[model samples]
Target: MSALLDIRQLHAFYGKSHVLHGVDLHVGAGEIVSLLGRNGVGRSTLVKAAMGQVAARGAVRFKGADILGLKAYQIAHRGLGYVPESRDVFPTLTVEQNLLLGRKRNADTGRWRLGDMYRMFPRLEERRGVAAGLLSGGEQQMLTLCRTLMGDPDLMMIDEPTEGLAPQVVAPVARYLLALRERGIAVLLVEQKLAIALDISQRVYVMGRGAIVFEGTPEQLRQDGGVRREWLEV
Candidate 1:
């Protein structure tokens, strides 16, 4: 079977500084793949390049079509959802309103619904009418994830979904991601938390110096102390 997302020799730059150098990776349908690395190793850049959020060269193929030069919105319309490390929620909009904004044009289509989001995070339902700015950091993160799901993306590229949150809040995020996989939505997760990434992902890739240095099942990564020390351990 072909990959749902395929990237080959991807190179990205900001001004004249190159960030990603010949990075290659793939995500298969119904798979949860994590990109792991310490800071400044270009994990986020790889996802941004895949989403057309940065200037990049080389191939980014989605379901067999070249998507390298497409604009961000165009790429999104092609069923790829991006949840940045920074949780971006419209401050003034009500919780429900924020979710409504994420709905793709033909409302009745897609696998996810507002009710599904609420079911996944009951707090969102409780605060359905509250302004998004009033939500706590954890709540905002959940909102952002649900908002992206509201778009009904076939593949979600999430960057650091558990960056800053109480311990109680972290597990739910993992469960939600697992649920996405169970529902057959492919995920390309970019995460720094080793335990969470390893626990939830079927496969993992470790990045170093803007390139993929290792790829294997989670169990293999757990046993490779050398790679963990060089690329993941702080």
Candidate 2:
């Protein structure tokens, strides 16, 4: 069967600085695929290139359509969601308002709603009236994830979702991704936390210097310590 998201020989650049080098990756429907590597290996840039946030060359096919040159908003319109490492949120807006901003004009056709988000993270519901900026780091992260879900995406490329989060928030975030998978939403996770990623992901890819070096099941990744030591271990 064809993949939900397929990227082949992908190259990404920021100005003259070439970041990704002929990378190839794929994610299947309802699958959780994790991109793992240390910093500066172009993990973030891969997703950015796919999202059309940077200049890139190669084939990016989403749901059998070529999406390489599409604009970022256009990509999102195609049922593809992106949550950057920045956790970009409207600080001045109330938590509820921020979520409201994420709803597509016809979001009712999608599976998610404010009630679902509230149920997933009761803290967000409790602080629904509070400004997003005033919330804790973990709370802000939850808000960002929920906002993206409001768009009702078929596939989500989430970058560094667990970065800088407190220990207590990490497990819940993993569970959140698993829940998305259960709902048949494919996820391409750009994550640094190996334990969480390995635990939740169906497949894992290890990157080194902008190229994918290993791709296999989480068990294969765990058994191969050399890849972890050279590409993943801090």
Candidate 3:
């Protein structure tokens, strides 16, 4: 079967500084893949390049068509959702309103719904009328996930969902991602937290200096301490 998303020799630049060099990756249908890397390794740049949020020179195929030069909104319209590391949520909008903004009316109708989001994140339902800025970090993270789910994306590229959260908080988020995989949504996560990524992803790709250096099952990644130390251990 063809990949749900395919990127070949993807190259990206920020002004004149090249960030991604000949990066290649793919995500299959209903698969959970994680990109592991330390800071400033172009993981986030890969995500932006895939979503057309950055200028890139490479082939980015989503679903079936080439999406290299598409606008960010166009990419989102094509059933791709992105949750950046910053967790871009409207500070003044109420919790419900923030989620409503994520609703893509033109998207394919699937299992995702406001009720599903509410069930997945009970905190959102509880603070339906509260301002988004008032929520805690974990709550905001949950809200960010819910907001992306609202778009009903077939594929989601999430960057660092557990960056600043406590271990207890990361656990539930990991569980939520696994639940998403069960529901048949392809997730491509860029994460620094190796344990969380390994626990939730079916496959892993270790990236360094803007290129993918290793790809394997989670168990293979764990057993190779040398590779881990070189690319992941901080």
Candidate 4:
């Protein structure tokens, strides 16, 4: 099967500080892949480069086409959805309004809807009328995922979805990602939480110093103490 997103020898820069030194990665259709790395290793930068938020030099093929020179909005129009580490929800907007922003009914139809999202996260439904800024951190994260789903993206790149959330909240978010996979949506997840990534992803790529150092199944990652100690340990 062809990959939904394929990035080869990707190099990116933030002003003079060059990051993402020749990173190569891919996400196959309907598969959940995890990008695991420690802080400052450019995992987030990889996602940003894919989303075209930063200047990138390399080949980024989405659905078998080059996406290198496209703008961020162009990438989104091509059916890529991004949930940044910060959960980029509109603070002043109501929950319902925020979700509406992602709805592209004229485009492809996926299993994501306001009702479906609410079912996946009942808290969001309960707070539909409330302002997004007033919601708790966990609530905000859930809202972010739901809003992204409204866009009906074929491939979704999620950056650190479980970060700073309570364990109780993290479990449900992980389940939601699995559900997305069941619906045939490809997901590329960037996570610092090793267990969370292992629990949800079928394959894992460990990033060290802006490059992929290890690519294997979840069990392989668990059995390698050297990888765990070097790349994952705090």
> RMSD, each candidate, Å?
0.8, 0.9, 1.4, 1.3
For residues 1-234, what per-residue lDDT tens digits would candidate 1 score against the true structure? 579999999999988999999988999998999999999999988889889889999999998899998998999988999999899999999999999998874777678888899999999999999999999999999999999999889999999999988999999999999999999999999998899999999899999999999999999999999999888888
Residue 129, candidate 2: C-alpha displacement in angstroms: 0.2
Put down candidate 4 lDDT per residue, 69-149, tens digits, no spaces: 899888888888899989888999999999998886563455577888899999999999999999999999999998988
Please, what is the TM-score per model?
A: 0.98, 0.98, 0.96, 0.97
State which candidate, 1 or 3, has the greater TM-score: 1
Q: Against the true structure, candidate 2 has what lDDT?
A: 0.93
Model 4 misses residue 78 by how many Å? Answer: 0.9
Task: Itemize residue pairs with steric clashes in candidate 1.
Answer: none
TM-score, cand. 1 vs. native? 0.98
Model 4 residue 162 distance off true place after TM-score fit, in angstroms: 0.7
Model with the higher lDDT, candidate 3 or 4: 4
The parts of candidate 2 lying over 4 Å away from their true place are none
Per-residue lDDT of candidate 3, residues 107-163 (tens digit): 355567778888877778999899999998988999999898888889999999999
Better of 1 and 4 by TM-score: 1
Tens digits of per-residue lDDT, candidate 2, 1-234, equal 469999999999999999999999999999999999999999999999999998999999999999999899999989899999888889999999999899874865779989989988889999999999999989999999999999999999999999999898988888899889989999999998899888989999989999999999999999998999999988
Taking all chains together, the TM-score of candidate 4 against the true structure is 0.97
Off by over 4 Å in 4: 107-110
lDDT of each: 0.93, 0.93, 0.90, 0.91
